[model samples]
Target: MASDVIVRFDNILALDNFSVSIPRGVVGLLGPNGAGKSTFIKTILGLVEPVSGDIDIVGLDPRKDVMSIRDRVGYMPEHDCLVDSMSGLEMVTYFGRLSGMTKEDSIPRSHEVLDFVGLGEERYRPTASYSTGMKQRVKLAQAIVHDPSILFLDEPTNGMDPLGREEMLELIGKIAASDKSILVSSHILQDMEKVCQYVIIIDNGRSVAQGTMASLLDQDMTKRRMTVRGSPKSLQTFSEQIHRDFEETSISEEFGQMNIVFINDGSFAMILDMAKGHDVQVRSYVPDRLTLEDVFIRSMKRDA
Candidate 1:
């Protein structure tokens, strides 16, 4: 739990009066580029101390129990942190030892975690020649080799093709299914939508929206995701007719449908009548709930 936390880097305030009660689950730390996500992770890990406010991870205070926190918390950083000369198994073992495990314990644990991360055979290969996805697996392997209680994954899908990204997300899903907790920080909202149960949206180095996925995006907005069947031109003209009749703001067309966003005073009854009069097909007319992407936009544009 963190309340009224402020983290500054020199003269700049990286996090501004941040307050959030993050529940234990697959939580995503969502933000735009340079929105203090990395800074927030560092503060939780005790790598960067906050200028003011309180932070308690599990039952321990980060300031006094840095090593204990490090021992139980796993971190997979976004940037490359691999040693070119070492093999994958050796890399994981080294991190395990650093987490207070003896060589005897680390050796087998490294193999088990590497296998769990889909790096079984390649554990003997040098990390220097590994692909981007493989390197990410190595990073993940090392982070969890010590069997930490919670994991922090920063930009788990940074660089990869479509297939690579899918595979990485699948691995993350498997991890999330386990008992261990996870906090993923990323600018990519799609991956977060796929795996996370909760989200904390940040902007301008401040917390904006934080809640469960369904709750945060549950409200219907000004737009409607209306799928219709008709000629493009007729849809356009009918849109104009609706605007003229019901004081609709605009009519935006995509594919075979149109977005009819209007004030609450406006009614979908007009749209139904228009469809009936024109003999056009109305496939579906449902309220448009904000997507995770849309919520991020709203959070950034609106003041915290």
Candidate 2:
């Protein structure tokens, strides 16, 4: 957790009164480039000293207890920080040892984590020989080799293909299920939506929005939107009826489907009744909700 955190570099501010109370779960850290997400992480890791503010990681102060914090935290950096000469197993084992694990413990633990990240036999190959996805997996393996209680994953799915990205997200979900607190930073909003229970959106080095995924997306409850599918003629008749009653309603049609948005006071039951009266066999009627991308864009615009 951080409060009133301020960090500057040679007159350029990186964190301007930035503050956030991250909950214990898989939380997404979202921002545009240069929004200070990486700087925030570094400050928490004690790699960047804030000019003013207090920061606590799991109860210990990063300023005074950085060593202790490192022992309990795992960090998968956004950029590649691999030693090309080292094999996957060797690289992970080295990080484990650095995390204070004994050789006896680090070796097997390295293999276990490597397997968890799907490196398996590839663990024997040099990291330079691995593909981008494999390299990303190996990076994750090293981060968790010591079994830290907290994880900071920066762009964990960078360079991964569709299947690979899905697999990475699944791994993150499993980790969250284990109760280990994770803070993930990714440009991919969809991936964050799939795994994050909470999200903090930042811009210009300031906290713009932070909340539970559902709460953030459902902030505007006054407007109701839904998609309806029916025959073209039936849909047109239904649309006309809705417009006649709810003058403020907006409807767009494409390929025998209609996307409708109206004031929440307009009842969905009434719409269904109109459909029935118009002899429209509603094939599908589903509520449309705001997505993480929608929330992120809105937050950035509001902050701007």
Candidate 3:
């Protein structure tokens, strides 16, 4: 958790009065490049000192209890931080010991986490010879080898193919299932939507929006939008008929659909009646809900 945090690099400001109460769940940290997401994570880990404000990790002050915080936190950084000569098993075991685990405990734990990340026999191979996905998996193995209570995963799925990305996300889901608080930072919005229960969007080094996924996406529920399908001519007539009644209406004949923003839920029934009157045999009707990408774009534009 952080309150009124401000971090500056000489003349450049990286964090501008940023504040967030990260909940105990899989929370997504979303922002474009240079938006202070990585800096925020480093500040919480005590790797980057803030010029002002307080930072707490699981009830301990990051400034005063950084060493203690490291023991309870696992960080999987975005860039490559692997030893070329060490095998996957050796690297993870080394990090486990660094996290204060006994060599005896670190060995088996490393193997367990390596297996959890699907390294298998590859764990014995040198990391230098491993593929990008393997390297990412090895990085994950090292981070969780000590079984920390919280995880900071910065671009955990970076540089991986689609299958590898899905596998990494599945692993993250499993970690969250065990009740570990995870803060994931990545450019991939769809992946964030799949895993994150709460999301925080940052822009211009400031907090743009932060809340549960459902709440953030449903903030404008009063303006209902839905998609309708029918024959082009009938759909056109239906759109023209309803255009004057609704406050806002849009029809895309190219897609054979219409979008309407209505005042109340009752308007849906009225729409169905209008469709019937216009001879528009509706094939399908579904609510067009806002996605994480939509929320991110809107927030960034508003901040700009």
> Lowest summed-lDDT stretch of 10 residues in model 1?
257-266
TM-scores of all predicted structures: 0.89, 0.86, 0.87
Task: Give the whole-model CA lDDT for all candidates, comma-separated.
Answer: 0.83, 0.89, 0.87
lDDT of 2 by residue, 1-304 (tens): 8999999999999999999999988999999999999999999889999999999888999899999998989999999889999999999999999999999999999988888988878889899999999999998989899888999999999999999999999999988888899999999999999999999999989999999999998886656676777878888878777777764346898887788776556566776787788877555555557779878988998998
Give the Å error, residue 272, model 1.
1.6
The number of the candidate with the highest lDDT is 2
The better-scoring model by TM-score among 1 and 3 is: 1
Off by over 4 Å in 2: 226-252, 256-258, 262-286
Q: List the residue pairs that clash in candidate 3.
A: none
Candidate 1 structure quality by residue, lDDT tens digits, 45-78 = 8999998988888888788998888888999999
Deviation from native of the Cα of residue 264 in model 1, angstroms: 5.7
How close to the true structure is residue 227 of candidate 3, measured as C-alpha lDDT? 60
